[model samples]
Each structure stands twice: as C-alpha cells, then as structure tokens.
Target: MTNAHDHRADLTASFEPMRHFMILQSESDVRVLIRRLLLSCLLIALIAQLVQSQDSEINEIQVGDYVRFELRGNTYQGPVIQATTNGRLLIVDVSVDDRKSRRQVKREACVRLTPAEMNSVFKPVPPASKSEPIELTMPTLAEPGEGEEIALTNEQLPSVDVSSPTVLDWSGFQAGKRRINKVPFDADPDLPYVLDISTGTVVYSVASDHSTDIFVSTDRPSDYRLVRIKNHTVRIADTLPQHGVALGLIRDETDHDKGLCVITGLSTGQPRVASAWSLPKQKVRPLYCHYRRLLPDGSVVCVYENTLRVFDGRDGRLCWHCPVPAFFEPAVSQGGRWLAIAANGRLFVVEASTGRCAGSIPNLGKETMQPCFSPDGKMLAVYGENRMVITRINDGRVVLDHQANVDLAPFGGESLWTAPAVLVTPGGYLMDLRKNMLVWKYQLPADVNEWMGAPESGWIPIINDDWLSFVRIPHQDVTQLSAAVDQNALVAIQAGDSLRIEVEIKDDVRGDVDAFKANLTKALESSGYRQDISAEALLKAEVVRAAERTDHYINFGTGKTESITYRPFGARVTVVHRGEELWSANQAGNLNYHIAGGLQRAAKQLEQPPANLFQTMQLPRRFLSKKFQNGLGKSSVSIDGVK
Candidate 1:
C-alpha cells in the first residue's frame, strides 16, 4: 500500500505541472485578444476625429462671416448675409460704388477673410483734395509765311483730372466736377480738333491761305508739336485721336504733299516731327477718313476704300490687310485683341493680331450701327436706333436682344462701355447689362451742350459753352436704407418657423404655378421652416408674364441660317406679415432670357435666403426711376409679431 501511494504522488506532481502550463497558455491567449480589441478601439477613435475635423472645416461658413470670393475673374469681399440650406450658395452684402448691394456667390468660391484683410477693407479712405479752378494760357496759333518754319509755345495747362478723386469708392460713388481749362474759349469752329482724355492732349488745326498749321499740345508746355505744310490744307482725322497720337491728311488742290501724317510723343512730354506716308489718291475717300482708328497698341486700323488695312505705328508699314465692304467706324477692344466693325449691314469681329475673321453677327439693320466690345473681349455689343444685341464670341449665341420703347440712339454722341455699366451718351443713360435695366439717366442742364465719356477712366466729360467738366453718373443713396433693412431682417426670422406660400399668375402668362409653389415649400422646409397655410408670415409670388418668341437670323461666323426661341418670364415675390410687406423681389422678363430657366433660377435663389432679406428683395427696385421711392424706409417689423 505504501509503494502504490508514492507512485501516485509522483504522477500527481507531474500532472500538476502540466496543468499549470496549460493555465498560463490560456491566460496569454486572453491577453492577446484584449490587446487587439484595445488597438482597434484606438484606430476607430482616430478615424472618427479626422472625419469630424473635415466636416467642421467644410461647414465653417456661416451668416455674418466675412468672406472673399471670385466672380467673373473679379475678386470681391463681403460679409456673408445668407447661406443656402444645401451649402451651394451664399448671399454676400457687397459695397459697389459706395452702395450696399446683395450678391449671390457659390460657396466653394469663397474664402474666409483674414482679420487683417477685413480691417483693411473696412478702413476709411481719406477723401481726395477738392479741385480748384486754375487758368493757364492756351497755345497761340499763328499762320506762318509760305515755306517758313513756325514754332508755337504755350504755358503749362492745368493738370488733367486723372489725379482727381475717382468717381467710384468702396463705400459708394462720390460725384464731383473738375474743369478742363486747356480747351480754348475762342477756338475756331471750322478747324477740326479733338481732345484725347487718356493722354490729356489736344490737337487742333489753324489754316490760312499761305499755310496750314497743326498744333498738338499736352499738359506740359514743353511738349508741343507744330507741323506746317505750305499752301496745303490740313484736315485733322476726327476718328484717329487716341493713344497720344494725332493723325491727319495734308492735301493741296494739285495733290502735292497729299498724304497722311501722324504725330507721336504728344503724351510722353516729348514732341517730335511728323511721320508722313502717302496713300493712293483714290483710297483717301471720305469713308476712309471717317473710319480710321488708332488702336491702343499704337497700330492704326483704317478702311482704305474697299480694304481694311492695319498700319504699324513705328514706320507706317502695312502690317495686315483684308478686303471689306463699306463699314462703320471700327472699334478696337480694350486690350486691342479684337476689332469690331459694322459692314454690309452686319457686324464683323476680326482678330487684331493676324487680321483673321474671328466671328460676325448678321441681320443688324442697314441703319447705322455702333459696335462695342466688352472689357474681357469675350462678348460684343452692337447698338442700333431701337435695338441692342449682345453676342458671345466663343459660340454664336445671342445673349441679349433688347428692344426699347423709345429711341435708343445716343442723343449726339456714342455709347461707352465701362466695367460696371454701359453709358449711352447724349441721352445720359446708364444701363446695367447684368440686370437688363437702366439704372440712371441724367437730365441735361441748360448750359451743357454735349456729353462724351472716357470709358477707361470712367469720366464723363460735359462740354458747355464756357468750359469742359468731368463728372460721374450720380448713384442713388441707398446704403443707409439697405443697412436698416438688413438689420431688421436678420433679427425678425428664426429657424423652424412656420410660414405660408401663395402664388398668383397673370392671365397672359403660361407656367406651372403649382410646381413653383411646391418648390417654394420644399425650399422653406429644407431651411428648417414649416409650411402652414395659416402661418402669420405669408410669401406671395406673382407671375406677370411668361412668353416665348422665335427669332431667325444668319450666323456670320458659320454663314448659316439659325433660329432661337427665347422664353421671357417675369415674377414678383413679396414677404408679408401682419398686413405689411416685410420684403419683396421682382424678376423682369427682360433680364432673364428663358421663362422656365428663369423660374428655376429664381427658386434656387430663394433656397438661399439672404441674411438681410429686406434689402435683397428691394434689388429690383434699382431699375425704377429715381423719382420712384415707394419702399425706401419701410423695414420696421417686430419678430414677436412674425411668430
């Protein structure tokens, strides 16, 4: 029995060791499983943190946040007034020409403005020194004896208004007047003369039986040129007064010394001799003389009889030439990239570099038409007596075809295209093409004789019997009014508020009114607003017109007949609460080309309500006449009442 017990003990001891080893192995496996679970939890937490950070960054834009954005290649900075529920659009309150205006921009295009940038943008700029009238001696012109060289000198003229305060400002437009004293009071009417505002230079002619004298004067007295051709008649080219160069013809009864001469360096404070070139006698017809133009790059474009010719400025060498029919005065693009001319009752756009036909627009009336290219060179605008057509150059697309109710022709001058608006001269009408409406019209003062504008400088020169003055089109003062409305709207409405929508259409209009109403309801719901017919806030939408018209014309670029059906739509919307209108918006059919397209765009606009809904709604009123002041200061509303 003792021996059996000892063997059993030894066996038990060995089994105990093995059991301990198995227990340790099981513990180690459990530890490994726990470690893997801990690692997985840590990885999941890190990934979640990264996703939250990205989401916050993407949704950082909010109302009242100052931002900078790009539109149409122009940079604009403003405060975010509204954001669309879908995060696609943002309404910004931007100051244009000192006027507070609401502009809608894509959210992706906006960047948060740095603190420094915001401060700088809001900083007040010192006002410019007021202009004081100063008199200077005008250049004296004396006819020289036959074959005698005559030199004329004049006192320094008043500095050009280029140094004057700009008509535009971040806060708004500042209207002031500056007098140009260089124009002689006793200037001969018969002699041709021109004032080039870009260079502050003037060229005039003095003719006598013995000699014809052409005098070129700049702001500096030392920079003056006098050209004398004995027994010859000098006629200053009326159309070639630009780029600090003066072009004219020196003609005699017998065709001796009959040629075109250009004077350069008139604006560089250095006057030099004339660069003379002879043209074929037959080519120097009246049409050629009237159609000549000096391009911005010193090249000269002229219609010589039946051909369009570009002459180099350095030596009057022919750079390029193309055959053309009878044409109106050609307009060179701001950068001299394209040349626009109306010929054979159509508009032709030619490449300034190679003289290749870039594009053309047909069916322009046979009546006189003036063509003007936009600053970007991507669009062309042709103005007629009753119609204005704007076309896109890349594709033969007619963007706008506006028929006016009155005579649309300029009173006595031509139309001028600036960055913000097109100034139709003589009539003093400032048309904002983006809105397709006339923003301002100046009533002529009794003393003012004519109106001419400097497109590059934004100066409108008014010629009176006494002197010339430069002034900007006066803009209405709506900054304070807009601010008041914006502030009121920002405080009046809250998220998740219940509202009602009502739509009304005119008898003449054709549209899906029900669809529009449904879209409005959806947009409001997406913005955290509940739609209730009995809600205090009532949104009213009225469609005044919706019609389509087919237009057929010849495409000058493809030389093919094309037809375009334009759908015109107009709508007016207002937000009313407690029997008072809190906000209003209107879309004129003339501004938008398509009915259905316009309605969809408008719905999208509504999806992103502006922070200052009142000011935004008043945007369409800018097109009204200045005397029309119906809703200027009616934004006082109670948020409690809206609820």
Candidate 2:
C-alpha cells in the first residue's frame, strides 16, 4: 500500500505545475487588454481638444469691434454693429470718402483692425511738430493754365468815364434793368473779387478809385485799394501797399460792414492777414498762408507748409494746429462746423473747433481744388482735373466719383452749390449730388460776352459791351420745356417711328457680347427709344482697338499697380423707311475701362437721332439747332447751345 501511495503523489505533483502555468497566462492576457482600451480613449480625447481650439479661432470676432473684410473684390473696414447667432454673417458700418453706409459681410472674411489703425481713424490729429520738415509729393499751388490773350484794338475797348462810379438799384438791376440805369466802371478784369448776391455788394481791388485801370502795372504800380460798390455808389473800402496782393475776401453774411481779407506780400510771397476790417475800423491780425478761409464764426483757418492752424478772430490766438503732409486750400463748412483739406495725398475732414479728424480717404486725385460744401453742410463736393467726388459729411462714404463732361476747375468764378445741385463753371452743367447725374446745362444769352452766375439765387450778371445786366433764370419755363421735349420724344417712339433700334455687335470684337447687348438695350430704353429685333433701324458697333495699360503709384507708403483695360470702338446707326435710308448717325465711343462700358457709351451716343429728325417731328425752334438737338436726346441737356 505504501508503494502505491508514493506513485500517486509523484503524479499529483506534476499536474500541479501545469495548472499553475495556465493561471499565470490568463492573468497576463487580462492586463494586456486593459492597456489597449486606455490608449484608444486617450487618442480620442486628444482629437476632440484640437477640434475645439480650431473652432474658437474661427469665431473669435465680437460685436463693437472694428474689422476689415473683403467683399466682391473690394475691401471695407468698419465696426461690427451686429452678428448672427451662428457667427457666419455680420453687419458693418462702413464710412468711405466721408460718406456713411451699412453693409453685411461674412465673419470668416473679416480681420480685426490693429491698434495703430484704430488710432488713425478715431484719434485726434497730432499737434504740428515744428522740428519736422514739410513733405510735399506734388506742387503746392494748382494754378489755372493761362488762356490765350486776345488783343483788342482801342476801337473794341469800351470808352467809359473813370471819375464816376455808379451802381443801379439792386431790385431794378435784378429785374433786368427795367428801371435802373446801366452803371459803368473801369476795373481790372484779372483781379479776383467777391460778389455778395444776398447784399448786392461787389468787392474788388483797384489801383485807384478814380483811375480806369484796364491793366495792372508791373513796375511803379500804384497802391491797390479795396472798393465796395453798393446802391449806385462806389466807396474806397481799404488801401494796401503796392506789393500787397489780395488772396481771398470774405464778407460777413450777417453784417455787410464786417469783412476779412487775406493778403500776401509780393516781395516775400508770404501770406498774412492784412487786417480785419469793420468798415472804417481796421484791426491788424497775425496769420499767414495764402490758402486761408474765414469761418462764419469769425475764426480764420490757414494751411501752411505742413501745418493747419486756426486762429480766434477776436483775440487772434492760435486755437489749434494740426500736422499735415502738404498744403492745400482748406474748405470750411457753411456754419464753420467742419473743415476739409487735402494732406498726405488724402482728403481729411476735421472738426473746425477741436481739430479732431473725423475721417480721411486716399486717392483724392492729383489736383484737388477747394472743396465746396452743400448748402446744408451734409454733402461735400470736390473737383479735380474734371473729376468730381461728392461725399457725405456725417460718415465718410463716397457717393459719387464721376468723370464730368464739363470743366470743374474754377475760372475766376465761383462754383455755385445749392443742396443736391452744383453748377460747374465755364460749362454751366448743373449736377445732382445725391442722384450723381447731370441735371441740365444752362445757356447764356447771345448778347452776353462774359458772365458770372449765381445759380442759387437764379440770377446771373451778364457782361456786355455796353452794360452789365442781370437776368433771372426761367426755372418754370425750363421745366415745362423739358417735359414737353420728353413727351414729344416718347410720342415719336411709341408711334413705331424709326427710333426703334436693334443692336448688333461684330463677332470680331473679343469681349462679352451678351453683356454688351443687354447694356445697349437698357440704354436705348432709357433714352426714349425702343429696341426690337425686327426693327428697320440697325445700330452696329465694332471694336477699333483693345489695349491694357498699367499705372504704378505709391499708395500709403506701399507701391501698387493699377491695371487699366480699355476698348475703343465706333458705332453707326442707320434707320430705313420704305427701303430708303431715312436717318443715319456715326459716333465714336468714349474711352471706357470695360468692353461692356464701351458698348454702353456707344449705345447712348447712337440713341440721339439726327438733327433733321427733330425738324421732321416739328419740335421746338431751339431744337432745330444741332447743338440743342443733341442735348435733347442725351441724359444731360445742353442749354447754352454748345457745339
């Protein structure tokens, strides 16, 4: 029995070792499974954190933050007024060129403005530094080009008495000299003058009150005297040195006797205040610069070298000085509330009282003239090299940037500005500021040789060989005439006349033909004409030349290039009646930056029928002239019979 038990014990020992090995392997498998599960969880958490960080970066923008964004190929910067819950769309308040507008943009496209940019828009202009030198990119003075002088024989000159100075009754003179005698005087035509239509007063510089000075003597010149003509009487206003030249004159609208005169020394060519004249009382004030204007509140604003200074009229104390890059004529708002000046190649508006910059815009053009404020001071108009820019004063937004057909440069005449209307000098084209379109063209009488117009008052001083007469603009009659002409044109078109045009663009012109067709059709309809495919009239346009040009400019210290592409074309429109050519006209397209724009210009030109067509329709007698007839068919009417 002992032997059998020993064998069993030995077998039991071997089995025990195998059982322990199995238990150890099972424990190892469990630990390996737990480690794999933990690793998977850690990987998922890491991915979630990365996604959350990306989302926060994208939606970081908030309300009331100033941001700049790109939309439709244009970049705009403004404060965010509202934001969508999803943070996708945002509403922005944009002010460009002194005009304000609201626009909606995608949040993804916007970037927050830097601290430096914010300061530029909202901060007050820094005080002028006397140590800094003036930086000038262009000429300071934009003098008008000299016109050819026409030599007049002594026979052509008017023979007038120099000792007598006369002025007719203001009311009678305004009423076409019905009961007033024609006043004659000898004054230097080249001298600048200020005419107050409200007070019927004229202020001009003269060599002497008794001298009929036709020409200003260069050597041994007599002292110039400021003269005032009112109530059929001429009186010496003030006398200045022979070297003193009047730069500008401003008469107090509230008090005619109170006036401010800017004078420059001929020898030094430095501008300074001659005096603030209170009729017989003259107070010499200290101020300098030819580009100076008198504010309505008796403050004087002057721009010199690289600084703009405002002086208190009562004490002649410097109110404030702003640092500017260059000098240009500063414009004052009607009530002296705002001031606009060109500096650093940009136009800036400042609070006349505090010198705080409201807003600024670059690319104001090379030669900006004195900006004119609207009657209500809400709109500002700037003219430069025939280009006009009208901006709203409250917010800096450009309402209009137009290349005007008329000359906008001041030609020894004042630019007439009434609310929403501007009458350009020389051309006499009245433009609507809000509408951004030409309203009308005024025609002067044949007898008038030289004229000055005050469109706001609807009266113009017409200078003739014999007398200077005033004529009131017939606004009511002009309105009626315009309406009648429009009616006649519409009637002529609706009668299935030859005005029905079909536009056909040549295939050789490499451009968007479909766009051209659509633009041409719309233009024809606006011009009181019909477009029909089956019409007997055909307007054909062909591209003469297509070219691209590049202009390099330094903008805000950055070099930039502008790609200018233009398509020059010509159009011939012909109308046939009963298989015979009834009317035909040929026109060359104006220079346009786009092919579609070129076609549109050509369409507008072709819309005007031949002058003979107006005669056939029995239009007004004035319409028979080619000049007047051309005006009637276009958007802007020519009243002065420009050829």
Candidate 3:
C-alpha cells in the first residue's frame, strides 16, 4: 500500500471520499455552520434542479402545509396547492421574501424540518387546504445531530397517484453528468491522448498553485490530486523508463531538441533521471514522443516528426536513430518487426531489426495519406481522399483497392486507415485488410445525426447527445445492421407500494449494499415512482451477480504498481402485476454497469420511455452540438471524413 503502484491493489483501503460539507471561514461568525449547510445543499441538474433535503421530515410534508424549500439555489416558502392539471402532484404557491408576488414551485423540492429547528419567534402565514385548513403545529420531533445519516424505512415513504405529472414530465434529463466521464482531460475527446500505455492511465495538465501540474486520477476523475507541476511543456513516453518509473521529456518554449528529460517514480514521485545530458543540436520542432515500442532486447523505438530514435528501455540511452524522409508518420508492425514508410507517392517497406529497405510500392497515388499496418503486420492500408488501398508488406502487391465515400475517415473524423489495410467509411463497407473483403457496412438513415468507426478493432463507440451506445462491427446484411439491439432498455412500470431490492453478491464479491439500495431508491423516486404500501403490484429487483475484474499494468512513472478494478454486474427487475408476471428485463454487464448507475439509469428509463420519431427530433443534441449544426461531420468519428 506504501507504493503508489501497489496502492491500486488495495483500492478498498484507498477509496476515501472527500468531505461533503465545506468548512466556512467567516470574519464575524454568528452562523457559519448554518450558512455552510444552506450553501452546500445545492446540486445541479440539466433540466431542472430537483431539490432534495437531508432531513427525514420531507416525508411528512403534506398537502395544505406551508413549508420552506430550496429551488435551484434560492429558498421559497409557501402553501402546498394542487396542480393546474389532474393526475399531477401538489405544487406550491411560494411567496419569496424579496418578490412582492408569488411563484409556483413543484412540491418535490420542498424541505421539512423537525421540531428542534423550529423557531418560536416565527408564525405560519397560511396553509393551502381543501374544505378546512389545519393549524400549523411545531416542536413535533427532537433535534438530530449534525452529519447524521437518516435511514428511511418502508413505513416513512409517502404514496401518490402513479399518473401524477411529476412522473410524466417531458423534460429529458441529461444522465451522463451523473456517470463517470470517459473523455480525456485537457484535450479534445477525439485526439490521440497522452497515455502511460503500460497502465493506460491518461495524463493531464491542469493549472494549480500558479503552475501547470501533471497527474492522473486515482479512480474517477473527481478523485484526482496534485502529483507534480511542470512549468514548461512536458512529454510523457508510452513505456516506463525503469520499473515503476515514468519518463517525461521537457523542453523550453523555443522548441529545442536540446532540452533535458526527467524520470519520475510512480510510487515515490522522486526524480530517477540521475544525469542531465546536454542534448545535441538536432530537430528544432518540439518533439512529441509517439508510437513508443519496446523491442525484444530492452530497446525502445519512439517517433518524433521525421526521426525514429531507439533508446534503452531500462535507462535513457540512445541505441540507434533512423531517418524518415519527407516526415510523413510511418506505420510500424505491432512488435516492431517491420516499418512501412510512405515517402512521396511510393510506400517503402523497411526491416525494423536492421533499418534496411526491403521493398517498395511505387505510385500509390499523387496524394496518399494514413498508412497503417495490419494486425499481423503483413499488410499496409493507405487512405486517400476517396480511395483506400491495401498492400502486402512482404512484397509490393495491391491486395485491395477500393473506392471510399468522400466522408470516410479512419482514426477520427477523416477517412483514415482503421487498422492495417482495413478501412471504414460512411455509407461504405468495412474493409478487412487481412482477407481483402468487406466484413460489414451500413448506410445511415437520413434522420441519423452522426456515425463513425472507433478504431481498427471490430467495435464502435457511439454517442448521441447525452446517450452512449456501443456495437460490434461486420454487419454484412440489413438485418444485422438495422436490427433492434437495445442493450440499455429500461421498462419501469407503475410499480408496487415499495421497491424490494434483493442483492445476491458472491461470497468473494465486494460492494456496498446499503448504498446501492439507497441510490436505486433515489432513481426510482426521480422517475415518478411513489411508494404505496396498499398497492397490489411490487417492483422486485434481484442482483443475480456481482463480479469484478482487476487488471495490473506498469505503475506509471511511480514505482507504485497501479491496477484497475472493474465492477461488472447484472440484475433483473420484474413487474408483478397482481402476482402475475408482467415483464422482466435483465441488466447487461460491462465496465459501465456500476450498481448505483444501473439503478439510476433504469429509473430514468422508466420515467422517460422510448421517444417516438417526432419526440426524438425535439430532443437536444447538447453533447454533439448546442444548436443545429449544418456541418457534414457532426459525430465524433465522421465516416464521411473527419474534419
């Protein structure tokens, strides 16, 4: 646990959360705790702020009661009044202290307090009620200790009509804000991120303490802390400089290759680079150490502009240097056995072991771009503006020369080579470099917003506004392409008096059952679900499995070994309509399915059903675009060509 790299192994011990409430420092502290409590209760939501109180007395807030509540960030007090329409929850005609008139507020955000917090100096103005308004009563319950966690029982939950408008609101809440953000920090999502590939932890540069800091988040992004600061532009290599050591190349703003580099331990954050060499005068442009490859004999190859420099993997020492004429990025074989260089219009094949040219493919085109090696390293795929050509690396032979859509871009938005010889373009087939055949392809419908293949691998990551989806490649036919493959289908019904969540975790599995239940309850309630002890139906969820997989990688530049723990779980929720089986859906398992997030999603899905054609059009593309974008490339990976 002392080693930062090894600390990842005992994640449960390292999972310490930040304090919820901020300590307020006031000059004249009369009610510092009171001010902090009021300020810290505020939370942000996309559509509307659903004000939730830590007080248990919220359950006792009834119709005709005058209560003070927070809305957005402001506080309001008013009488609970019926909604303007039928089948809607009670709304409040709140009289804000500053406002001369009244403002209507949803009763969901109302807060209730125990008798201990009641002030004898205050008096109830009026209560909204039916035939007769009841008198307000105070001093009902005793004061609770600060920071006390109030656990709600089934008896404390209030029941409301299932058809209430609160549950039927059309506001589509952005759910991703509540989930783990997978995008890179301090860089565009589509850009090739600076990663410690050994550990796959993306590096970030954030301004802190009047300096640019370099660090990686422990688990989630919010859990990030200060690691080290870099006053200048820094470059981190793909592999370790030493066991649990991270090596970063640093240079001044002049873009000189003569600047020195440093090796920092991942565990201790101590400088491991003992000697600072006065570098030789060479390439002037700032070098970004990319395409790092570790060879068989503890040697490493890294590419920067037109230069491929091999260095000792164990220690920072130059081994060999190869020149890449014309400076187009060359494609190397997976294990660094062969390298494909596209110089001018011809593609030259070179032996990586001896840096000797073997063969050449003459006259690819006047404009050839994005040359990539196949998975087996036997073939190379070159992407052009409208054509993709796959050639064998051993001998100069064109395996497949196919016309691509003007919109096809491989790596990102442009028609780039997805893998060695494999290319995916919009409205075209997914060409496989290995077999010189189309594995699968699709033509997106007119209404479809955006699309693209993620990488050379067969899977594609799709994001539509706040929604995210993934699908496997090689859909050769229409049935396979357009088939309804709903991995995130949630069917929430007007469920029972209570949600009975049964968690069945394996003996070795570790999770927080209480936290899981509470989160699920919150999700269900947000989705228009009301607890009714008298209801005949019950929504029963059984977590059939709770499993986790831990992966170990090089402990960044710190000697501390780091590991990633993935919680892959599955559960099933059944709607029991008067003891008859109504419907059931099984939760799929993946890295995305955290117990709390799954429940929140299911609840949200139930609250917001599948949008019809007309409904989806009105939905906001806040993630992809704020307003209507007439641009051709709207999605992350534009098959129609990345911009």
Instruction: Give TM-scores for every candidate, taking all chains together and pairing residue i with residue i.
Output: 0.41, 0.36, 0.35
**lDDT values for all models:** 0.44, 0.37, 0.36
* Candidate of highest lDDT: 1
Superposed Cα deviation of residue 90, candidate 3 (Å): 60
Candidate ordering by lDDT (highest first): 1, 2, 3
The per-candidate count of clashes, in order, stands at 5, 10, 32
For model 2, state the Cα shift of residue 549 in Å: 13
Judged by whole-model lDDT over C-alpha atoms, candidate 3 comes out at 0.36
* Candidate scoring better on lDDT of 1 and 3: 1
The candidate 2 region of ten consecutive residues with least summed lDDT is: 17-26
Off by over 4 Å in 1: 1-243, 249-258, 268-270, 279-288, 304-307, 318-327, 343-346, 361-367, 410-413, 425-427, 442-454, 460-643
Q: Give candidate 1's TM-score.
A: 0.41
In candidate 1, how many Å is residue 123 off? 26
